[model samples]
Target: MTKLSPETILQHACIGVMGLDNNGIIQYINPRAQELLVCDTHNGISLDTIAPQIWKQVKTLIQQGMNEQAIHIQGPRGGIEMVVSPVDKKAKTSSDNFNGVVCFLRSHEKFESSAWQYPTIKEMHLQFQSLLDHSYYGIYIIDGNGIVLRVNDVAAGLIGMTKEEMVGMPIGELAEKGIVDQALSPAILKSKKPLTRPLYVVKSNKYIMASGMPIFDKKGDIRFVVVIEHDMTIVKELRDQLKHARQVADTIKNELSDRNLLELKSHEVIADSPAMNQLLTVLLKLAKMDASNILITGESGTGKGFLSKFVHQNGSRKDKPFISINCAALPDMLLEAELFGYEKGAFTGASNTGKAGLFELANNGTIFLDEIGDMPFPIQAKLLKCLDDGEIRRLGGTKSIKVDCIVIAATNHNLEKQVQQKKFRQDLYFRLNIFPVHIPPLRERREDILKICDFYLKRYNKAYNQKKRFSEKCIEQLQGYHFPGNVRELKNIIKNAVVIKENNVLDTVLPPGKNKAVPISPPCEETAAPPASKGLNEEILAFEREKLTQALNHCTSTRILADYLGVSQSTVVRKLKRHGLSVE
Candidate 1:
């Protein structure tokens, strides 16, 4: 038999063969090598540019001083295997004389051998297994045919099975066997892309987030599916618990809000009328919001002060101090010192040890500035600064003390009109009016009048230990009257009636001739007084007749007469009969 030449043998060889110089430049590549590498160039080309994956493994081996030994590497293409061996042209005995390398490539389908026949392949497999075993999260790898090629210890444990029982099993079988909730690798193969889904392991009773990524071959075919599963049982439990807690908190808040609205009467706030009730509803929500600056506007004696306190009591700062000050009651200089506080020896009558102002004293609470419309212009500027910056300087000190209190200002005067008249600062008004609450006067919410009257009647009745009850006529008179002083006037009238009434059934509360409306004139010259000389009883009768005549002139009917005289209809008729008076 004749020995074939090296070039003829290489050309006829079934496996791929390539030669590289010391510089890693392809010196020669057989036809089979070109086909396997998908390279058109035959020579003088860098191996790094042609087969980068193979070059990487070659560089790794060379760096490890193992280039002389034949080593097998898993090539870039799926099922493509490579063997790299250092070439010594001068002598085959030592690698010191090696100047180039020869690479033998073969398809894995065509190669069959034992572990010892390819030590590098066995070592690479061991390295891969070691990496998978060391991972904290479950790692599962499947071949393109949906068969499990390898699984980490974590993955096997999560499935409640051993690595031996899982390898070579199809992914679909895991779901059908009740091992996992569903197959995730199939979706990755279908989309040829990564997919993430929530998964449940039946055996372990654990929730997991499985992220599947597809490994594709150079031909863009699915090569393998890699799935990483992270346990989500604790996170899911925490999220559910948080959601339940929030729902419970919301229910409690709603119940408390309704209860607070109903208990407004206990706070001495009468909101029975639709107008006042609506206002209270808004105030309740504002209180819950913990509004910083709120302005209460209404007529005098309409209970602005009570409403201010109501807001403070229901708010988040209920535990803090509540300091109230009447702006109109204090002089300018004294008011400033009282509000912002004064330093020691700051003024002529300053306190010896210095005093904290209402604002400072009311820190982290609420400060009710009653009659804020009457606050002096000079002090309004400083108050505005405090509101804007949340800090106030002492009356005569240089340092600013920070205050975190809610400022609720109440005013009977029309602040908008005052602002236009230049009597109040417009900016300050805007600041305080961020959340405005307008209490309707007694006349506007007349329905609340009877309720307020009854409340005060009961209060005063208890306080004075009296069982005096207003007669039907008296109730009619009280309800019909146009209260000029609002609730305050009503309260005082009820207190006086409950305290001074001699009989259990009180008939008259208002003075003899005082009417619901302010008199057009103080009682004409004739109705004013009887001549002192006329006897006492005769004088009393004459004066009563004169006031009756005057009331009759303005009142057209029995109801009108009763309302004008501040008496019930029956009282008016009886008084008319005694005085010989009648409506035409």
Candidate 2:
């Protein structure tokens, strides 16, 4: 029972070991330590040079006479745990004595490769079987011949088969679920590369994405194929939802377009006064003519564009393309390209295949130029040329293409004044003024207010799928207001009311304007005073008279006044007669 010496112990131990003196120099090195450190002998190598990071801590322990301690060290090869213990207590005679520190080294847990080594083939098989039974992702391994060597529990469950039944089956059998074609296995075998594709498990009624990668052996030859399958049922469901939403949006768009067409067809120019009727007659006549270049002038939101469209749709070009372009919507270069086609490689980032301008697209049709006054002078010249001569030249191309399109210009500005100020071309203005169609403002067409409201109300009701109707009071309030935004403003008001109003009640929270509702006061108590004091009925009559007077003063004609009052033109005339007033 003799105690083994340090050398004898080191010879038998598997791990590396070395002893260091208090000066941080390697005093002893075992054969295993030399091999582990990748050094022959500690001839010129010091403990600090071999492991500087750990030596610092060791020096501190030695200086303080610390007891047994251990530290984890990282090296180029791998990680190691080093233990230091003092051999003798009085060996440090003057801090440079021959006293030694015994060092024991062991490989780190992660660096110890012995865990991967199986004692026997039976042990390795059991470990693989256990992993295959518990993995959530469908796992399968195939040999070089595309034959399945192993199948996991998840894979067996996905294909509605037991692991024992699926094992040793051809990999092609799983790929034939009608998700991917039958040629996928042969392709993977030929290419020896990874393949990924979306597939559905017919038996489980679930979608899955399958990926297979080739495993190469030490000779760089394909040894096996590892396939992983992920379920994609939620992803497919989300995609379907997005597609349904787009379809619903398209349906709504088509319905809106149909409603707009119906409204235009049923609309009538309602004006009882001679002056307004004369204007409407001229517009209607011009709308029917094919040669007139109509210029519609009005204030912003005053139905200039709407009337322009009405003219086009009712004209001889009704079957042709009715293209509308806002002249002021874009900058000069973009607007030029939009109107004129650009050649390939004309400028940086230009479309490689080039583009066709709007003018060419409007050939054999009619082009409605909205905000004509806002078009740049250079583009205006081109437009004038296109009108005089039926030809257009692309941005960078030399060829001039012939066009047969009618031009319909619309504006909210006075083009005559623009022409005088040299802002607009006089010749262009005269060409456009062949037939002038002036759309009177909302304040001038009071007779059409309620009609327009009813139209808009029905439109919004169908759009929102709600059963709502406007009350008589709501109609009266709408008619009484001066719509500065014109027909467009009226349409917006009706739309907003439709959204806010519930159960057929119009919300009174109107947009900002003089037409906003004023709070009315209750009738005052009649006191027994002099006979000269006006009665309640008389006072009410006076109030009504004053309102009628004010409305007539601000409006263009009686028809407008009647519309604002939400009453018939005859009622307005009768009221005017009773008050001894004339709508001048």
Candidate 3:
């Protein structure tokens, strides 16, 4: 049998083949090997001469006789696995006797067994190319030197470039265009793990989310990086819509809270008489004075506080805040802190950001101090200083802040009498008394009762959507009675009558009894003076005490007792206390 030559055997092989010595010198190469390497088939065409760098590394492994196994090499066309194995022992011995160490080379891209399906070298190459070209996601394979080894169609289209142009380019070029640098590169390199981040694609000027992972070989060495990009424009738009919705909701919430606060602070006051009109006029005038400190005096129910709001709104500072503080509402320490702000951490439970006091919030506005006579004596001096200097220092802060505001003080007590009795500071009263407006009791304004009652009736009728009116008889009865609780009592009476009187006319009478005409004593007796055995003063006093007892028994409240007796509530209280009776 004739033996074929090495050159003839290699030329007939179906895959690329080459023969190498133990030192990795290319002893022989076949036609297929030359075609795959893109090199010429010339004499002395050694592996080192064709691929100098890879040959040097393979030489060291070959010397150990371990048969450097199948290794994948990425090339321009596709990937190829090169398997190096020792020749048959007899062949190796014979070859050593003739030439040098011998090795048989086989291309791992092809195999015949079912276990190795997709066996043909051509089939494997086509399969890998199909995956790269048809993938849905953008895929990029970058080497350790930061040069792109291969980019799929998806990745090439992402940067508006062809696959051939993208290959061999530095990854930094994409970064320079502000495409995926800041978050992508550092995360993959530093953490050496998979990472996802938002990125802008320069070619399309679109937003995308990029995820990258480091690829490791069997030896755990980082070989390449694989990056995938997904577009994110729709997601960003949805987020913006959600943020706008939240802002609109917050604005509505704030508006509703402000309206509720306004309603809670407002109070109703009844007025009709000329005396009350005169007082209101004076208050309006005082409110116009930008620098005046007005004082209001009246009984508890005579609407002193309601007039204060009138003063604030009619003033030049109407557009600014109108802050009110009830002097009797809080304890001394709290009142101080509420009127004068405190520094952060000044006291336990204080806000971390510090709070603005009412006075600070009321700058360029008005501050209504209701029940001013009840303010503590110790704080009066500080208040007086604030009025005099037009400045206030916070409870814990060192700096003094100047303020421009109007101060309106209202109380039922006679401040002059309180000053003389040492219950109020004389200097503070003088400072606050730039203008004094005194409102009269409701009884003194008898003509205005029916008018005020009709006003309330109409208001309630409109509110309830009912058409109700007051009867002449009921109006007469109300006018005839003396209201000791003043206008406040009159409003309450009308409100109660309108609520119970569902019909067109309100004819409900007073609680004591229906109105009845008193019979005049038979024309004064000229002879009656003759029967005055007992003193007239004693008889009159006895008759007053008897009436008081009867009225108290018939009334449910001191206010009602005063109404029945045709006297003031204070007058009833004084008489009850004088008679050793507990009004409560």
Candidate 4:
């Protein structure tokens, strides 16, 4: 039998085959190789014309007599793996010492065997290096010690570092310097599984999404970690932009809704008592007129804020802003500045571009002045003027800005008593008294207790992740009890009960039986007796004044006062005149 030539042997090989020269030009390509590579060029084609990536790495390999285990080159139809081996031209012919390399190409997708054949170590290394260098993702190969062995161009560019600088660098050192956090790589090695984390590349000021997988050795121990990274900076920026856009849209929606019209509404207040239901009907009727100023009288934390919101939300100007401020919270000066915005530099540290006051912010809307009794005496006069004239001047500006805001003031104080004592202006008191809404205390509406209890119990159960039930005994006990804090107190009791009780019945968090509410305000001096003076006449007068004031509270009539004090009617009238008490 005639011995087969090298070309004949290669052409007959089962896998694809290619041979190149020292100048990186393709010398020979078998039918299998052409079919796998799908190259358009024939005999005279350079390796670069067929596959640029393979040419780039394979040329260096041939020059150094380096070989690769396997490499995957892509084409339109399929992917081919190339295993390279050095070709000895000197042994074949003396004319050339280095002919090039013979690459054995195999299609991964067209494998006939169930098990894959491992390529030689040299071929494997070249294949891996080629794939890693040209990948779009940033790739890092790390050893068990967390030292980077190799990196791709994409990875280096993300950190603003060259591959030369990163290779052999410890991942811990990179993290310490804020280049990219490789903490997940360590976890992958520990768990022998893949891990992913979002990282901020401080050096490049960009966000990266990184995933890492552990590569195990023969002993099933993690030998190295391969981390792949993708840029997420644009996605994060878009998310923030979306959040801000939603906020702006919500503001515009609120601004444009229900403008300048406060539609009449009934039963906005949550109430079951006859008094409350009747009061709500009247309140809605007055709100429909939209001409009268309103004064809401109720204890602190008695759903006053909720009622204020209801008034604004259900009224003609319901679509407009309902601005509320606590009159007692700030000092006189700060309250003035907040109520009426100052001109630029009106006071030390004032805003350079004068601010708009709550009243201004509430223009064409409703401004609820809370704790109105606590407002300073001077502000009260200015407030009265503003209410009467429909205009207000800033703290320092001479110009009075015309405003059409509806004023709704609320207080627990007895403004009628304040007016009689001269602490509150009489005219302002009368102006606010129009369409008065006097919310009854909880003790007067015992029927609402169970309804209010169920409402708050359901609310707090959802909040605290509880399903506590109120026993019949518990319900009766709560209903019988006087809630001085009213709706606010009931809400707190239920809230605490939900947290404390583990069983179906909430009996642990019930409040003490004492019904008196804690006083929200200090006693006005008008009710206090005159203090004793140094003189005998002053001491006698103080005693008389104390007796008269005490009597005045219960018995306003001189005839009744005389009967209660065991004194004559003329004597009672004489004492009333002397002490400046009314004797109607």
> Which one wins on lDDT?
1
Alpha-carbon local distance difference test for all models: 0.81, 0.72, 0.69, 0.75
Q: For model 3, what is the C-alpha lDDT against the true structure?
A: 0.69
Query: RMSDs, each prediction?
Result: 12.8, 25.8, 18.4, 22.8
Expressed as tens digits, the lDDT of each residue in 237-304 for candidate 2 is: 88899899899999997676545444554674334434455665455556566754778777656666
Question: Mind giving the per-residue lDDT tens digits that candidate 4 earns over 1-584?
Answer: 99999878887887888877766688888988887767656887898877777788776666555544466667546776678766773443331355577788888676524223545655777788888888888999999888999999998887789999999988777777757654667677677889889988888988889899888888988889999988888899999899999999988765544232222222224577888767666665566667458899876446665676766765799888888887765568988999988999899989899988888999989998877877888999989999999988998898999988878888877898888988888999998888788887776777777777887787778887889889877876777665556676677778778878778686545655433233332322224334555697678888999988888889857667866765434346556767877644
Of the candidates shown, which would achieve the greatest TM-score relative to the real structure?
1
Q: Write model 1 residue lDDT over 261-297, tens digit each, in one string.
A: 8877655787688898888888888888888789998
How many Å off is the CA of 385 in candidate 3? 1.1
lDDT for model 4 comes to 0.75
Rank all candidate structures by their lDDT, best first, as comma-separated numbers.
1, 4, 2, 3
Question: What shift in Å separates residue 522 of candidate 2 from its native position after superposition?
Answer: 31
Q: After superposition, how far is residue 105 of candidate 4 from its true place, in Å?
A: 99
Candidate 3 regions off by >4 Å?
1-272, 509-584
TM-score of 2: 0.42
Q: Which 10 consecutive positions of candidate 1 have the poorest summed lDDT? A: 518-527
Runs with alpha carbons beyond 4 Å of true place in candidate 1: 1-140, 144-195, 199-208, 216-222, 230-238, 257-267, 270-292, 313-322, 330-366, 376-406, 443-454, 468-484, 502-584
